[model samples]
Target: MVTSLLTFLSLTAFPPAGDHYSSTDSGRVRLASELAWESGRLSGNQYALLTNSSSQRLFNLADSLIKTERAAVFFSPEHGFGTNLPDGVHSTDEQYKGRPVVSLYGNKKKPLTSDFGVADTLLIDIQEVGLRWYTYLSTIRYCLESAAMAGIPVIILDRPNPLGGLISEGPIPDSTLMSFVGALPVPVRYGLTVGELFTMAQHQNWFPLMKDLKLTVIRMDGWKRSMLWPSTGLDWIPPSPNLPTFQSLYWYSGTCLFEGTNLSEGRGTDLPFRWTGAPWLNPADSILFNQSGIRVQYDEKTPVSIPGRAHKPKYENERLPGFTMKSITGDRSVLQSIRQVILSLQSAGRPLTIKPYLFQLLGSRSVEETEEEMKALNDFRIESRLYHFYP
Candidate 1:
């Protein structure tokens, strides 16, 4: 099969188009759309799909590009191929569209020598949840390393940050605790697309051995740094199971901290990150909780929601109501506010525990573990800069 496909490519002629391209009024172009149509990087076996909404864009482009005798491959991240797997599920090798579909999550987070031998160049198009802990971001870094090792060029088709590029939050991850979640010193809400992230990653010199890395980014035309996912005018496909709506991710950067606790983090419920709690939480008592100093650090609003109506009372209300968040003026203030709440809750013997440890979420205990570090955590939000894609 490989021999036959290789022969077809050897005899074909693919023309290169101009740098910029546009979409028609009614049509939605996928990430693979631009690169697939033109000839430069199509010769090698093509591969993509490691994160949320990434496969949608990749497959759309692959179907558009794959023609007579053209062979393309698609891969998946922490979730299995097609992202049918729930969060924390491992990926298994599979086949779809008559092409090889490999797993980039779980056992094979990083690419081995064999993956590169299958394709000459690789293309990455994933929808990241914008939080640092999400595995999708780590998958991208691993791909960069693999492509570098194999001497293959990687093209990233960027997408918008759902949290909006206007604001960034969180602290600089200590180098010692760097993991897939904290790939670099980036803030929790690093407001850049996968393409922009590639550029930043390069500048940060995180992968120094990947010196020969060949990368080209197909930047979005209609996107602006300030625009959130909804403003992009692109279809809203759930990038991950939990990120069902833009609102989910909008509140995730801070709310995700709940993951370290015994709290629900709203996973079993419909709202996931947006509606977080354990049975012990009294919506009435906790109503003004977020308004406090430490709680405010994690939530931008003085009051994250109205008390009794917080959960939307699964048995009664069907529609999820939202409350206005208090405008947070500074990151340090936000952190201070959140710490106050957490400590208060703990002292009150609230079911919440420090076990999951806030430090685990940051991928470091350095800043969150100590009073001085927590002070630094509050200041991390102020340092984050919004990314601008174009002039």
Candidate 2:
């Protein structure tokens, strides 16, 4: 018997013993912190950590080896160490779990020697949602460059990209479009794991100071290019406040584009990125979006389905007619969702302006405004020629 592509992609259940291991089962892929402790590598090493609440277990594993949670201090990214802050709301320094956590958002987008205190190594294990502008990637680059200045090594305990490490999509970001949202230009749905990305950056000399920085990535085991979240057999940890489920995360690439426009993006609703409707659009008439795979549904295709909180979604009490998203191919097809929504808005004469922010939200990558949507992205010279790490 032969298997289908969908069958291979939808291989969700745990594999048998001694085969492909997962943290859920065989635990083949160990966290860098965990591996360090087991190999007696943490001894006599003064290392600072760059982590958040979702990935705190890595820190804890390290602490168990060192016998003290007392680091000189800890470094935190966007949502703070506790992962409790709302989007765009600046977080102040706070003592979390007995260690001072420094904010890495707003003007302080990168790390400094001061943030590291007396430590000489940095451990990064933030669960990135695999989007170019998710900011974790930027945070990693900053840490790399700062580690170079601080003369330290960065050990990345890589996490599985929710969208998997195959099938790169969307356009390569223009150099002019660089921001905290996008440190280096890659596809919006880049296919590399965080560690793989770091390796590429280091080899590409993207970070001049850290081009030769001593970097190590503790990679996952049993993961493949085409596998999505379910195939990993790992649980979901919300990378940000807005994205609460695999469904929400899958729909994020598409719905996130709405942030650039005036549309509500289902902010206040329970399905932040999953369902979108604006006051001007009517639900019954289907004012826009007639793409083959585009859809509006309560349950979306994913390894799992989870309902998240939307305290004050856009058009709260008023009726806003919009569409829900689906993952005809893993939710990574966010560009499709985005392209359709833009067409819908254009058809409705909603004045979808291409402000600088619109491009920024799209990670500065070029998207066609006309009906001919992008099926394949324009490959970058750096990506195709020099920086690629995958086979």
Candidate 3:
């Protein structure tokens, strides 16, 4: 394939990948001279793979490529072509700038390359929200698998995980609960950049063809371990519909648990996932609620101990008051503390009954069982620290 393309076109067009180039402190560089070699010799149909978060890199890379190569096919995820699709809006494929825009989301997720009829190289540049529950990761996994099967090389433009790269939380998904959402067994906060995550996935031999595929990761230049999302010096565009800010990212890893329950995950309000409520909660019940949303309930299954007081087992109503939304942070300390609050609510007799599909988000039943497993999580964290990608 490589030789045929070169034969069809002049051999001087494409530049070798090994040429080293450096960027300034901002990681921006002037276009290389070789890019001008093949200004306009071929038909325009090759594709650049990008999701909402990594879409910015598209223009940067395209500026250099269009100087020589033809225009590219663009692939998008759940938020649709331009990422303007609202929370649950149904999206359709369309054309932009004479190039076809393909939707990798909606009912069918696999790359419809056959449908497109002629896109060879698929460049992927999606932003991951750094949570297991987020759908973008699954979209990438599917794209990778399909691209490998079709013998397409994937170039991944890397970006930072907003929750930092040091911590891993939540439980690994069990085989039984696996879905598009939980494509692999990484923790809810598996702290690797999308490029590195693909590296780990390929190394583990998960996708057979993907293992041998030609994957090039354009890693972020100055990204460090402690630099949170705001520190990146880039604009913060929400990668998905509900995840608007870092606060939403923080509450999402835990509060996403609400998807399995009867209460609203705050979808209708300005703050989804971060502020949860039901019409059942009123000012009359506010006094019993805790700062972290846990309120005591009297049920019969589990009992509690106190000073001359054996409190009856109960369902604790977790009231997520407003402005606590502002307090959201996806830090390990914050996650662990939130985990304690959720498990405590579970131990208090409200054993969370998850939806069949949502079990993938929480990882597994082993992750859901309240009292014993939570303690095990602490132990797991210590052991998992060895796999830590960042400090």
Candidate 4:
């Protein structure tokens, strides 16, 4: 059945529209939130905003709505309104500029009809890191479900996928593995902007409420599928507290898998997701690199308790020998390198244990099997392209 779907997609998929950078000017990319506010799209409606600190760097959508009396209640995703809270930390309801700020993380992942208060619309403007495991995608899905249930429309202020929209990696997750981290069946690097992703979901019937949900995506002006964060001419705002730099986000696709393992995935350190190490990790086992354009260096680092970032991270206060990875060409898959690292550690007589959380992160039990499934996702990729707003 899957083979037939792939073959059909291969025959009917839309042809490439050529490279966006070749024809269009790659100046400062204008955000959809700024465009919506400048125009009358964000006016007159008492809307609730699902946003974080990342959305405020260019234009403060929350502030603009509040000042105009269009904001009814404020909603925050995984990291709270400020985006300063640590991972897994529960965000409480609070007051933001005299407005009720409700957290979409923690106990309540979705909003109730009453949570909307006197709002008629829901405005979402959070910046996404272009990975499935990032909780923002799940939050967006929940918001859509809630909006559909409440009969309110959702206006998504689109942002650029920091990793660009070209290369997708890893497997389309199994349905049984659906969680907050792996909400939908998209690959690890799904390669779609948040708006594009939700649009694909709604069109493809990924969720039941998607068909009933009224969604309006305010598209960006100059973003291209080929342009990464650096190419977009926008400042790097840490979507989360740990991903402070573009370099950290670059290697996050693979290194984020370290979070499920026994090793410290660079949490509580200066560079999270870019560094992975443990006390048991042998220095000799670190010589593992199968993927080209990836450089690894051996280093020693200790995880410490940084308030609001990584409070009591794994292996905290313990100096461990580990390697830091740097991408030379920025196109190679770090997933292969990390997989090889796991194999090498096991080969060197290290008692490495794979946890159940690893399956949740990878969306499958075996990395090799997931890679095989990823190869057969031509149909899914082509179907995704049908909803692409940009070239």
Clash pairs for candidate 4: none
lDDT of 1 by residue, 81-148 (tens): 67666666676777766766668876777877576545666777677766677778888888888888
How does candidate 4 score on lDDT?
0.80
lDDT of candidate 3 over 105-209, digit per residue (tens): 766777754743466666666667887667778888888888777878776666677777767667766567678678776777777777667766665466676
How do the candidates rank by lDDT, highest first?
Answer: 4, 2, 1, 3
Backbone collision tally, model 4: 0
Clashes of 2: 6
Estimate the Cα RMSD of every predicted model relative to the unseen true structure: 9.9, 8.3, 11.3, 4.4
Error of 4 at 341 (Å): 2.6
- Work out how many backbone clashes candidate 1 has: 14
Off by over 4 Å in 2: 1-32, 57-59, 62-66, 284-287, 297-319, 327-332, 351-354, 369-391
With a 3 Å backbone cut-off (N, CA, C), the pairs that clash in candidate 3 are 49-123, 293-318, 297-314, 299-313, 299-314
Candidate 1 stretches with Cα past 4 Å from truth are: 1-18, 22-54, 57-59, 68-72, 292-344, 347-349, 366-388
Residue 45 displacement (Å), model 4 = 0.7
Considering TM-score, where higher is better, how would the candidates rank from best to worst? 4, 2, 1, 3
At residue 266, candidate 3 shows an lDDT of 58
**Alpha-carbon lDDT, every model:** 0.57, 0.63, 0.57, 0.80
